[model samples]
Target: MSTIRDIVILCNNRMAFPAIQTLHSLGRLHSIGVPVENEDVKAFCAVFASDTGINLIIIEKSKLKFQLQEITAIKDLKFIFTMTFPWKIPEELIRQHPNLFYNFHYGLLPEMRGADPVFQSIKKQKNETGISVHAIEKEIDKGKIILRKTLPLHTDFTHGMLCTHLSYLASYILPEVLTLLHRNDEGMHQDETVAEYYKKPTIADVSIQWEHQDSKSIQALVNACNPWNKGAYTHWNGLNVRIVEVSQTDTLSADQHAPGTILEINENKGLIIQCYNNTQLRINTVYTDEGFMSGHKLLAFGIKNGEQFATL
Candidate 1:
């Protein structure tokens, strides 16, 4: 006879909602909750409140460590599946649980290990990105890969769009991963030689490097940071200016101008700025101190041709 595993799901993000619902419908989900209060967490709690069959535990962010310690004492907890759980699981608990702990990471294992993989993948202009189901270990994301599902990386995908797509993908693959675990299938180990890690991007990291990067790279950076970091940024007359939507222009200028210099201002074609490699970026949408406006409106705000946007 096959053993039925009692699974505890710890998640706080909306991306895990679909997967949570899938597990709940199967009647195999043991417990669910978040480590903190947020819009996503509140939404999940409110939706599941009517279902008295499932137990939801909302641990205070400050008391998460203590609460996780208490969870370790739950008898017959065969597996713990963490989906976008904010806090790191205690190493002691992982050691005690052995192969029972697993996590759903947004990025492919080994290659895009660490925080904000979608953003990194978009910034790097990757051809593909995927989700990974892996064992949780002492190191962050350096775990054994159980299952993976790849998706095409679209150039126009904003931060929010990529996250939404990944969430659905997570929901789709989770049942298969559970089946694999039930069969006691040990996952494949990750290759450390090809591994890459990225820290959460700061404002500086996402800021547009007009002089150093080409137009294509700049456009990718802007798209990668959208609907989350509010797009890649620059400085205009000491004021912060965010480029929300941009496109690379095939039109090349014969005359050389400093990078970040406004090359052309056309109502139909938008504002064009010189970038590295003699390329140009056509700004479609922008956010400045005044408010969100199109590139053509910048001319009315004293931004003219030959004006250079400063980078910090």
Candidate 2:
């Protein structure tokens, strides 16, 4: 229960809420910095700062380097923590205050190291993931590890769900991290041999690869994209569509039918489609230009039982 002080947090969204609370409770949160471009986070932090009597610094994304240099000049500034902060710190700034900065990355480092590991882990069908607190170094997410708190990746977890879970995990792990830092612990260096880096996911990453992905893989992709990217992107009869929710079906596809073929459309069983293997996926919900609707409603949009949805 070692209480620390003179800390600042840089963040852009709700993922930082838990950590902010933990630091404030310990009386270690001296200030919070939010990019002015992030309207919701900016407004929320403004009110939070007022209520908690913590200082709030509004930052311009373009002027991040200058602003950070100024903020770090405070004689009492002991540590700076960034949680989901958007801009990369200037390499020179990191080099100058290497010990003063740390980041709470919402992913397991050395394996799931990346900007969007929450999405990547779910998309890759990993059964476990964790949060990593590491010193901020020149290379992004390549810092030495201070602490890691892992959790089971539940089968029903979507990208949003896992993000929420990991945010709380960050709060739970923060005290231990602060205690280590208070003791001047240098922390362990990451294993370069097993290290990997995942850049932020893009449209192509969320797009479904019908030709290569089986039913399980497709379902994982769907979960990985839901409530975040809307869903897994695909094309149906020349129209863009997103598969929002799906489940594996017991029925196997016939050898003659290619992957992405519409095998059946049962009212009770939902819309079933062929996948890479003989397995099938039962679509529960979908999103189209019309709106988000039930999978069965695709019939009204002229998607018949034989209509196929293939990769673009």
User: Which of the numbered candidates is closest to the native, going by highest TM-score?
Assistant: 2
Q: Write the per-residue lDDT of candidate 2 for residues 86-132, one digit (tens) a residue.
A: 88888899889868999888888878887888898898888899988
* Residue-by-residue lDDT tens digits, candidate 1, 1-312: 223336678887788887877776666676786765676776666568456466677778777767876766666777788888877888987887788789999988799988889899899999999899999998999888999899999988887888999999998887798788878888999999999999989878889988899998998899898878777889888778889999878868888999999988868768999998888989999987788889878888788888999897
Off by over 4 Å in 1: 1-5, 51-53, 73-76
Error of 2 at 116 (Å): 0.6
Question: How does residue 294 of candidate 2 score in lDDT?
Answer: 80
- In candidate 2, list every pair of residues with a backbone clash: none
What value does the lDDT take at residue 88 in candidate 2?
85
Q: Candidate 1, clashing residue pairs?
A: none
Query: Measured by TM-score, how close is model 2 to the native structure?
Result: 0.95
Per-residue error at 65 for model 2, in Å? 1.6
| Candidate 1 TM-score versus the reference | 0.92
